[model samples]
Target: MASPLRFRRSSERWNDDRIIEELYSHLDSNLGARSVTPHYVGPDGFETRRFEMDNGDMALFTWNDDFAYWLGNTETPPALWRTSKYTFDEVPYQIARWGQRELLADLTVESPWLAKYDYLSWFFLPVLFSKDGRETSRAFFRKYDAGFPDTTRDEALSFYERFLRTGALDDYRYTMASKLGTSQYFDKNRMSSAMSEFTVAKLLTEAGYDVIPEIEVTTGHSLDFRADPRNGSHDQSSLVEVTRPQPPTQRAADTPVAALRETAETKSNGQLNEHGGGAVMFVDCSGFRDDEWSAVVGEQPDVRHRPAVVFRARPSGAIDAYKKGSVPLSLSQAVEWV
Candidate 1:
């Protein structure tokens, strides 16, 4: 999938004057894009300009040395047409830095409430600052604590910030980050469900496995993740489908175990059932506290599937989890078995 945040790299040798004229002609003719004089000198460049289109799209162009980069929510301009695109990390460092600064500026402009958070701002830059999702994405984190209930906002943000800093999902930023945004605006359940994938990612990588997101199966459904052992030891990978049960207090099920069982059963009958059982089901009970988890651990109710793992995680890198039905991956290093 082409992500919204990728950059189009151009090595065309058009002189500076001709380049600007061509861009202006193409943009103005096609998108009614208008620009003011560039106010900043980008990395190794004479100027960087932001163009606003009549269709509510914004594009940024920065020229430095012999190369130019085009980035925006809009389609690539004719000037950068036929150029190969690169992700944030795949571009030159200076280009990446300048583009990030431009993107960061857009984010701050759209959601000033996020201006104070340094880590959260950088980690979700792609989605939180994206043209379509800027407002909704910021609110998901700002108001919902990124979907962690019973935890302070600071606690939740700080925990996830550390995980993101590791760059585990950096390559999949557009697809993963935008998931938080493109949901129904401020729809808590859908938005929280998106964050559960990230939590599972943190768990899988910490267990010495590489987690690949959005794996498509023959059933025409995308499983949440594919965990391959990071070491060269394993030739096989494990498919994982994650389900996060709403905390007991907020759901129809009166008890924590009852709520989890209900949620897991629903998943077991749906996607996993259609998948026909190779994937492991991950039940994220992170919303539960110590007392709530104690009842769950004692019962360890069947999730109606084989190769399922049930666990709770805290933001401080402390995880208590257990496996059922012979899970192939070894997670004992990252998780303390309950």
Candidate 2:
């Protein structure tokens, strides 16, 4: 767990001159020579301007939309508003690195709006690193996400430094996923599910499988991950469904085993055709144990899915497999298991 993020709402009155200076200070570093022009869009709208950078990148900067309102009264600081855009496409690594620097510096004095966005960049920019086709990078993070920071900009900067120096970007995606899930910014369930799916995909990839996350095999049916053995044919592949099981305190109507079985059986009978050999199920068993899961599966001697494999994934990254009549194989080995 990391420190909680804090946002300050200032009620102090500000004039156009100071606001313009703060805007220029944050924007001029990336944008070169430019004239400042501010226009009133309306209440709840933004004051906007355009500038061109020395690097030939064009940008539009928006000062606080709420700043004009807070000028007369100091009751509550208006929500800080700032946005920027580049004419040319910018790379993810560059943006991530820039975000790291921005987060380290104190922006509360000049412009908290950019600071807020910079903090969010910590959550979003790393996504590009994974998107840039860095499977290993994504895998390392997904596996060791607990080592990274989920909140607090300073801690994130520390994590980024090591991530950059090593060029591994370990735990970056997972950290972002964790924040998105807990943050008030996004839908909790969607973020949590995406994080779980991403973790499963990365785990499978690290296990020597080339995985596709959230792949839709049929209408209204998407497996957490679908992967083929690294050097094998599609027939050797498996469709994996992942779940983050809940504790008894948080448990609802169903158990982890029941959920795992349902998902596996859904594609048990030619659902995947010959594209996948079988189904691999992973339950985040940090809330449960191997013996507990075994008890549930043990009752069903002849399971619906004959070749189904269930994995109990502990929070510490340990795994236990329960596939009747099959050898005790690691996840990678099971990928090619017959």
Candidate 3:
């Protein structure tokens, strides 16, 4: 894969002269230079200018609303006030530093690439503050607006490519909550559960496993949470069964377990009669309780087989595995199981 590209600082700088030159180059052919005039500079360092297009339209630019306030003066010179009544309202078009930052922040929140390369802040400031600030701002905004959809399309394509290469796009999505107007941290258990399931399914599909989810096997009238359809023919079939948080003790006698076992046995027999015998494996993920495990084995179990995996509720919160003599799985260990 290619390394990520960086946006250069030198490419982002903008100044008054450069802005004026660019605008002149753009408008010169249509509106002759003779029609353009430099008026006055403001106390805040913004240049006020006026221009007449060849088509006879007039426009003005200034830093603050001083020009507008002056034009409203009843005693002001009629010549100045005459055109002042026609003055373009540049105050609304003027960009403040904070406003520019806010705009960049909004864009960064939506487009990961902008934030990824740290180019949003550099790009927005000049566009919002240059001499032709209004035009620059409009152009920049429009460019991003037009490009966003394509950027999103490109991201989707990239995710698909990664999926094909890695058999899983584990980091493609995220979820979070908010409290007191602040974003709450992710719940690790919830995130792990979702990611594990998604990654497993994606990998299986990529591997040509003919995977199915929540499949209903007719022989035992049981719903298999997941299955690989390619494992068997009509008479004989092999399948893997997964159980999570083993049925609660309250429902220990649920018929699902019996039904699953029956399906596996029947499928094995059918396959054996038709071709050869097949094996079915059941993976039980009912993690052990710390206290129960310690009482049974007299010590803590290995980190990989810790029981906290079964009862995890929040990813950011700690589990009390110590109470039951069990331990939580490390991230690396969890990934291995997945």
Candidate 4:
């Protein structure tokens, strides 16, 4: 295991002018032309005219919101804020005087483990890398927790140089899902999908069922959902299979109902039998229209024991009429669990 990184607490009553001067001196020696004049935005939302430092490198000094409150004054400290390279249109502000945006991006990309706890960049890269390869970046993050000092800086820089040489970062980036086409609308879709899943889980819980989502039943076989152990009886639990419907489509005359039936029967007889008196049923909340539902029902077995429910769930808390006592539930109706 790697050592943890140390974080500094906010100091009381620090000299902002001296800090800025030190930062300027450091940047002038290290990164000259890339530095710009520091801009200040005041409480009145007006720009301060005089005493501004402009040396070609773009720098901004803004007040720290928390520190302003702690001082028993509303005046904020001038700090450096920059646009984040990790998130789309996300600009994160920090109190560092040197290497504002450039340093932020460099540190994030260099240290994959720091990505896990939400410093700035997307942490999913390292996560995917670990899942695919055995290399552990967790140690890198642990070292970051040790404190940013001279020795730590050298160590971190060395690690970054070696990491770059190995081309490990390339693998990390390739495994991540495309961030393109992820507009606000697409974000809304993801949010809706998550909320919909939560709603279904909540409904099952309220209806006296134990629900588990994204569970891996076997080594390679995972289910989108499963509900079990209802009525306080482990043997009397039930299983639910959920599906999210896409745009309307004509259902084929021969659906995969037989496959579903066979699987359900096998699970009930094999796994459920061990629990006591559990049953298996399919619950399709795929928002299919009546005709689509009829087509699926036509292919299912006529046996009454194998009961299936098909219903459409709307975001506005409305559930279509239940078919044969199978109830359709929505988010609002299932809020009790949340």
Top TM-score prediction, candidate number: 1
Best by lDDT: 1
Report the lDDT of model 3 for residue 67: 33
Give the per-residue lDDT digits (tens) of candidate 2, residues 1-338: 22122212233444557655654444454444464342223223434443434533232333253422211100111224432222111323333233334322323323343234443334433231221222222232343332222233344333333223332223343433333332223232333434455445545655667765555764456666657666663336666765554433334426546655554445454444333544555544333445556655565433344444545443333445556444222465333222
Sort every candidate by TM-score, greatest first. Answer: 1, 2, 4, 3
- Which stretches in model 4 have alpha-carbon errors above 4 Å? 1-196, 229-235, 245-247, 250-286, 289-308, 315-338
In the range 1-338, model 4's lDDT, one tens digit per residue, is: 21111112232333457544644454445444233332323333222111222332223333342332111001122322221112211222333212133323433555644542332123222231222111223332243311112234344334333323433223323222121112212232232233334344545554555565544554344444566656564444444444333323322223444333443355445434443432333333333444554454565343222333434433333344233223232223333210
The local lDDT score (0 to 100) that residue 280 gets in candidate 3 is 27
The local distance difference test score of model 2 is: 0.40
Off by over 4 Å in 3: 1-108, 111-161, 164-185, 216-338
Per-residue lDDT tens digits of candidate 3, residues 1-338? 11111111112233446435643344555555332443333335444444445533233334332332221101222223334222111223332232233334534554444334333223322322222232323332334321112233334223323443442222221110000011122222232222233333443344344444434454443323243434332222233322232222323434333322343344334532233212222222212233332332333222222122222211111222221123211222122221
Task: Give the count of colliding residue pairs in each prediction.
Answer: 0, 3, 9, 23
lDDT of each: 0.78, 0.40, 0.30, 0.34
Q: Candidate 1 lDDT, tens digit per residue, 210-263?
A: 988999999999999999988775557999999989888888899988988899
lDDT of 4: 0.34
Q: CA lDDT of 171 in candidate 1?
A: 74
